[model samples]
Target: FSPIQRVNYKIEETRVGRLTNYDKLILEVWTDGTMTPKEATVSAAKTLVSYFNQIVSPKKVEKKEVKEEADVIGPMGKLSVEEIGLPTRVANALVKAGYETVEELAKAKKEDLVKVRNLGEKSIKIITVALVEKGVKFGE
Candidate 1:
């Protein structure tokens, strides 16, 4: 979500309480009940900004947690795909196909690895070079 200069309306309120951008300033607006849309938004924004400046609390940011699925990745999150040094498309396909680590890819049989949709002989050769660079050889 993009940050606004000022925020005044409730973005969403669920059972977990009001969910909003951590950086936004949420405030209640009380107009004469006959204000136009533009006037209301402008006035409410001003009040929100004013209140935010007067607040003493520090802003909080939410951090996202990355979780690897066990059954899917199958004991293979040790090495990053970037370390494989394969061409972009092939390396990305390998990662997407659940080979998370170079060691895991090295353990696979050539015949089996050839079955992957986007990977081909040229990509396989590239992968071999990458694995050899890391002191690993496929089908060892």
Candidate 2:
């Protein structure tokens, strides 16, 4: 529930190339403390675009079945490094070093992680604490 506080719109006659009678809509949206105005506007725009797309296509769109990350990795392994509350720098380093998931990080040796760029003892300690809080052990 994104609490939008206010919404305003204005229509103006505009020209698009040779089309001089085209109407352009300008929307101004405001939100409560719950969500940012930009977020609300983007969400509304996406919803409208989707509806327009469906209207134009008419035919029902077939949704492809996407495999869940948990299926490829273990359940806990599907958790992203960022989800463990690691700092952006530390998480980026781990992800760059092919430790994107909690399972991969949990299985990595401290020495191996230390070899990764931008990671050190402090980062490792932070990662360890976060993993332990999630009932996971750092390192094999």
Candidate 3:
């Protein structure tokens, strides 16, 4: 049996500026009586570092042309809620309510969106503003 009893993680996206974003990862690990949580965490970290060291090199890498989903899904509607740059909590709430894309959200009624968990008038207003900025509007 493994010494780890449970593991949990949460990822938060924070915007540093207009174009820069950073992700904060929070990890919680539980262990049985056999090993201390600190020891287990240290071991995991060392293992990850070893793997990363093996894959990474000192040479410079070339950047590739990445395609945007908007090209395939249309224009603004295809854009993801995260891409719209809403707060992490708001974006997660919207996605949880089955509104993953801007187009899907635009077609949803304000009353229905308000019923989603953790969403209220302020979140609705934020969504409205974001959609408007993208040249879209919510359904009546």
Q: Tell me the lDDT of candidate 2.
A: 0.84
lDDT of 2 by residue, 9-95 (tens): 999999999989899999888778787888888888899999999888887779979866444444667788988788999999998
Which sections of candidate 1 miss by over 4 Å? 1-77
lDDT of 3 by residue, 1-140 (tens): 78999999999986767744788888888998798988999998999988888778544678977755344235887789999979999999989989998878877899899899999999899988987877775655
User: What is the TM-score of candidate 2?
Assistant: 0.46
Give per-candidate clash totals: 0, 0, 0
Give the lowest summed-lDDT range of ten residues in model 2: 67-76
Report every candidate's CA lDDT: 0.66, 0.84, 0.84
**How close to the true structure is residue 13 of candidate 2, measured as C-alpha lDDT?**
97
